[model samples]
Target: MRRSLRLLAACTIVALVCCGCGTIAVRKTSNVLDYLYPEGSPAIPARDVTLTLPLRVGVAFAPGGTATRRGASDWVNATAMGGEVTEAQKLALLERIAEAFRDRDYIASVDPIPSLYLAPGGSFDNLDQLAQAMGLNVVVLLSYDQAQFNETTNWSITYWTLVGAYVVKGENNQTQTFVDAAVYDIPSRALLFRTAGSDVRGGRSTPVESPEAFRAESAKSFEEAIDDLIRNLADGLKVFGEEATTGRVRGQGTPEIEVKAAPGYSGVAKFENGRYSGALGPVELGLVGLLVVAGLARRRSA
Candidate 1:
């Protein structure tokens, strides 16, 4: 009987040890390619692009296969396990992006669009509809991918004691996030430029606290990645402007660009071939000419 008891105890211990060595992983992603080309890749035709000055722009997040809203507990569970981005979060992020372009002279307005308006794999046709409805000439789409993994360390064996589950740091957790922004001209269906950012974070946590810890870390990672993306986007805009001015961007029959003043804009501005000139209006020009002629007459009399 003693030997049998000892054998049973050993088996129980081994089973518990095996059970402690488990892992959990979750992934959530919104891919632009998947949203734009659901059926398959289609050949895109090149077309001319006319860029009106003071462009009306819209920004939005790409839709993925997930619910847009959830309860508090559901949100905690979802975020802890790398679930989809919520609608509220998307709006907040889009607002931040809009601020980046709001002050630019070339942009008339930057509007935040909700993901609900777009369907996955909607392609250019969907964009065309949205552009028309919103009076937007350009659109910026944001997509993201996030993953979280949790695994038991060798020290996890202590979790069997119950108290150790709360006090022992035996869970290894890692979170990785990536975000991308693609700018497109709505009329021509042309991809003007794109920028991206990514981040990875890792830490150890007690088994009981892993869920909350993972959630916090995941949010932090996304914030950091977005900051990086904004910096890169600024650089990309500068480079694109330079290229457009040099005529290099117009190569390969990409798109023919024409710049014209927006309606209701009274200030005289001339933009040709991606270059801006003639800042003065006709009225100002006339005054300057009059001053020059008057000065010339005075010099002759002297």
Candidate 2:
């Protein structure tokens, strides 16, 4: 009698689980998340400084460094191009950076430096010369790196139960891309701000198949990462512009130039309670749904 009862209980539990386990078809998806790294400490103020602009802002690439060259390998490896960004994408990113500066009420106009000017490994003298020639008081030096990696994931029998009984097992391919950016004030030649962002998307084809295949498959992820990085850069610039224009300068011997740390997880990119304040997309929804279903399963079993 006890054996029959146990069998009945087992069947009842399976029925409940099966009823809840519908098809969980996780389709191909793209998701980008921007992260402003946390600040270490407050900079020591040499004195105070202020910026009043009819600010001429331009974006130029930073000169190659050991790290920069290594990062740019992603581009070289994928497209046989020495640069990480294509010429068109470079121009677009520059214009976007300039526009961020233009949005400030104190700034009159912003322009892109037509030539790819390197700052001699970020030397202030070299930057000063470049700024003067361009008639720019502020130069936004942007160095970018984009990398895509792919891996295949398999769905097991346990996952099949949640997805649906008829769900077939197969490999789902995914690719991830990254972008990094930095901003500087030319007059002071201070590193004003820096930020980085990345995105992951499921692509139709494997990125490693060939250069063309990699580019085609990962283009969306790359674009999304760039856009998010630009937005983060713009947000940080807005705050710095406000502070420089309004904040008081003190002990005016020679104001020490210090680059303020990027405001991490602040402003519109509100990362509160471990989730973005923006609308939850499919990626986020999928995660939450999985968690909820798992909890339900636990309760039912108990």
lDDT of 2 by residue, 194-248 (tens): 6766777664332123344445545566567767877777666556544444332
lDDT of 1 by residue, 240-265 (tens): 66556654344555676555676776
Clashing pairs in 1: 35-121
Best by lDDT: 1
The estimated TM-scores of all candidates read 0.74, 0.50
Off by over 4 Å in 1: 1-21, 65-82, 248-253, 263-302
Clashes of each: 1, 0
The candidate that achieves the highest TM-score relative to the unseen native structure: 1
Worst 10 residues of 1 by lDDT: 67-76
Regions of candidate 2 where Cα sits further than 4 Å from its true position? 1-48, 65-83, 99-104, 119-122, 152-175, 206-210, 245-302
